[model samples]
Target: MSNDNCTSNVSQSIIGVLDVIAPQIAKANGLLFWGVILVGVVVGIGTYAPRYRRHPLIGILFVAATTHFLPIISSVAASVTSTELLIHTILINDGLNSRVYCTQYAHIFLIFVWAGLVMMVAVNASVIVVGDARERRNIGPLKAVTGAVVWTTYLTISTLVDLYREKVATIQFIEQRTVANVTVLGQLFLIMYTKLIFKYYAFYKAKHSFAHGRSPSLVDGYMDQLQQLGDNSDTPTILKQGEYTEYDARLHPPALIVMGEDNAQVDNQPYGNRLKWIPGQGDKVLTLDRVWKLDDMDMLQSPSAQPKYLVFSFTLFKLLRCRFAKYTISSASFTKTQKFFRYTLIKGSGAAGERAFRIVVDELSFLHDYYNSSKPIYYSHHGFVIFNIILSLYTIGYCIYLMVIYIVLMAMGYHHSQIYCSDECLGEIFEADFAGKYSDYVQRPPSPVPCDTHADLIDGSKCTSYTILTWHIATTVFEVQQNQQQHDKCPHNVAATHLSRYCAYLVACYPELLTDNNDEWCKRLYEDAKKEAARVLSTPRGATATYPLIVDLLSTQSTHSVLKDGASLGKQLVDSGMGWEPLARFWSEMILYVAPSENLEAQAEAVARGGELITLIWAMLSHAGIDRK
Candidate 1:
């Protein structure tokens, strides 16, 4: 009894002591987070600038970006949502520090640090917040900007308070420590700054910055590798008469294993073919103006003229070398490699043969979030891969939360205030057709190919999904019939085919987004349509489902099956000889009709997967205050 009582007493005392010091413990926020950030920084440096040019680390960065989210949440909870965790403990006081008081060192040091941090926050935040033309998979601009504002504001406030403390040292710590809470933004800033700093140390400093004096052997050996690549490519000393152009648009870099060079050739959009310079302030934001580039000959003629694309040596051996032995690299010197790499990547032209290599590297870096460095997941470790996938999902959820906050804030802003924008900007963004209602399209049908060919689209009262599927089938039938007549793949042909297929895809794949409050019904409707489509469209044993047979059956049959209705429409379109341009216009209208959705759950899922076309259109419609009745 005595021994048990003693143990119990001691345990109670320890608990009592820990409880008393809880406030002080909470104040160790900066110290504790800094330790984690430092470790992350070190790990990140090794991950990106590995001793050799073996593989890419950009994918891993995206995967790892999700890591600090939980910690951020926990930190916020601990500090009562104050990100700075301004010490409320009465025992501790910042004003009492003798060394920090009104000294020359404090004032000068504060000025330098404050100026540097402010400049960096402005520049870095802009780069992060403004959408990059080259990077499609980054955290969207809204989230980036919001995060920047939140973090910078907190940090700025803290810095100002500290500066004031340095100058006017009398009992100000009481006022500073009395600050209640800074909110979730402070925690978010820590994660963002940690990521940004790590990126700076690993990618920018390792590849571009020349502050770190590079080794002699590293420089010499890297040049030799370049020489070997040049030799293997077989270059002429002088340009041929026809080969020379007034201004070459691109610069090709050396296609290294780390840049997905081993598998670049297999893709239609080759991994090594896309490159953009590190966007300076001069680089204009790539507008959403051209969603899908219309079929232009410039797209075709450009790739054919470049022979250096052949120089990329993609092999299974090289891929495996990058995958399994990324850390193990050739001992090469790179003293002047940073300058050469910069000029070769950022300044040179495609005729210079540096473009391909630059593309592979730049794409991997800029589009780190969207692409995996390796074939599947970049890292060989399955544990981290799975963990990252979970974190990514969490990050997506958080982004969606931010989006909701954005919408709420927007609504609040516009409740009593007028939205001010130029008429040109409004015209560009909020087109009437993008609301995509069937009623709206029917009211303004394109001429010459009268609404008779696709009368099903005239009824806005029908289930949106049913109309989409039926019309898409009809459009496909007509497209197949007209395939043998066209010489060139025109924009109309491309647009009609793409939109028709994509809308049908939404019907088959994303039915939940088509209906209001009847999710179960939407899903069941899809299954029924799918079954009907299979029954009606199925071909005979070892035979093709020809357009004529499909049209005849569809036009003749009178059933609830949407495919039959579609075939009937296809027959009308065929008889009318509907031009590709008009057919394309119909599809454009149909796509818009289907894009207006209210299913927030499906939308959230779609947004998490980098957003589908329908999702984008739906968001636009929501912004425009258009809704299905």
Candidate 2:
């Protein structure tokens, strides 16, 4: 055949083939691209739509910035390859610069770009999926093995595809040389960024949790012990510290009440300035009900005070040991308030083993105000919700548009085309692609570095592997030590106001527990529990049920008597040479002054109960010391 005729026929054939595939390819690419974006939309909505609108906007911006990278390439390719002459017919007949040649090249480049984007996004999504799966499944070694196998399969497939594309397609830039050269560099940078962000978030959460007292789990391991004592115990003696219930409403007449005090402040006014520490302030003393003698003018001048332990008996006393209620009151004619508390005490074995305690707090009158039908004068949280919904809808629409454009570009041969020069190019692309994934990789929180390196490395298998210590681990260790020293009052610097108070309180309360003696005792007890198949509290973050055992002394009649006996045993405990004496002081610091509750009557009751418990613990300690002698 003549060369001209051969070229002409080939040109026609190429044009015919290109025309058939271009439209279908474009459609498929468009669908796939949009599908991913739609997935992102679902993710954004499902994860963040319920949040404020500002969050949605920011999330959309982030996903749009990150996910649209691949689609953008497709858009650029589509625009460049629009000319009709860029079809295969021109390539065969007119040569490389013709419209067909240019179209073919553009189509090839576009394919690689789109493929890179798809793979990267798919991998990232897979990472999130894998994380969620691991979290939900909470699987062990077997699943981990399975996951490893799957990972290996993916890597093998990726490597093989990368190699194949390099050999087959001339546009092997992404999978080969481009990926390899830049992956490690990208991974290193990403890791640093993640570390900083994680640290900042962790610090914020820890501080927040401390400020707004974290909730203590009701079902701690101590629950079973406490319940056992509560169930089998003797009937408790109920006690009243002051007037159990007497209300004289004539003290502050209804007509004399100030309007400001009577009117509830519900205007949604901001409570405190930024610099003011409002949340941690002590409770205000509000006068609720009082009685004034009509004849004695001196009674009005003197302060009519309630008992100090009044609040503790009402609430916290219930959680500690059982209590004994002892009632005795003065017959004085001066002004007085009514208070009540319930106590249950369990008698321990022997004269010295008796234990008693309380968990209640002091009571106070709580005034409940009726909601008035005045027009509301506050900003609604609903407005932010509405804004978020609108923002999410806009994001979804924008994402859909990008998907369609990407699909068209992919159809025109801009992705997965057989084009690129060398093996080096293929290597670069694969590494770059793999490294791109490192951006989303979150490293597990760094564990404490093992001081006993030999023991850690030489397990039952006796394998020796040196573990690398992370900077985070090192920093956390230092911070923990600093916290410890602060608690110890070594520097005597009250630099941390609220934190310092708590640290001092903890130190004063658990001085023994913080020392080597308590550590040794706890270690033995914990180890024994492990060996005995007993349920012991494990200090795992997020899963830690409750703190370790807290001793209660209120229940036992033996405890009550010992407390009664402690009046004598106190001198004996002080006389004993054993170091156990200091514990009495420590115990005093720890168990005293539980947080005041908002219940007035309940608070007074708890305080009374708590006092009974305190008396009981003291007796038990005294008896214990005497027995040791």
Best by TM-score: 1
In the range 1-629, model 1's lDDT, one tens digit per residue, is: 24344334333433443344344334433433432342343233223222211235543543343344334423433342222121212111333211111111112222223222322233233221111122221222223223433544554466546645643323232234323212333433444454355333333222221111111122223234434334332332110112222132112222232222221211122221221222231122111112112233343556553323222222111221221212222323121222323444334466544553433333233223222122122122344356446644654564576567548645745222111111111121111111111111112122231111221222235577666767777777787687645547788989987887776566555666665356566555556656555555564721465668767655554354565667777778889976789888988877667666656545544543345767655543432334464
lDDT (0-100) at residue 82 of candidate 2? 39
Error of 2 at 513 (Å): 47
Which ten-residue region of model 1 has the weakest summed lDDT? 429-438
Clashes of 1: 19
TM-score to true structure, per model: 0.30, 0.22
List model 2 lDDT by residue over 299-385, tens digit each: 344333322222223222221211111111111211111111111122334421221232111211110000010001011124434
Flag regions of model 1 displaced more than 4 Å.
1-461, 484-487, 515-517, 539-542, 556-560, 624-629
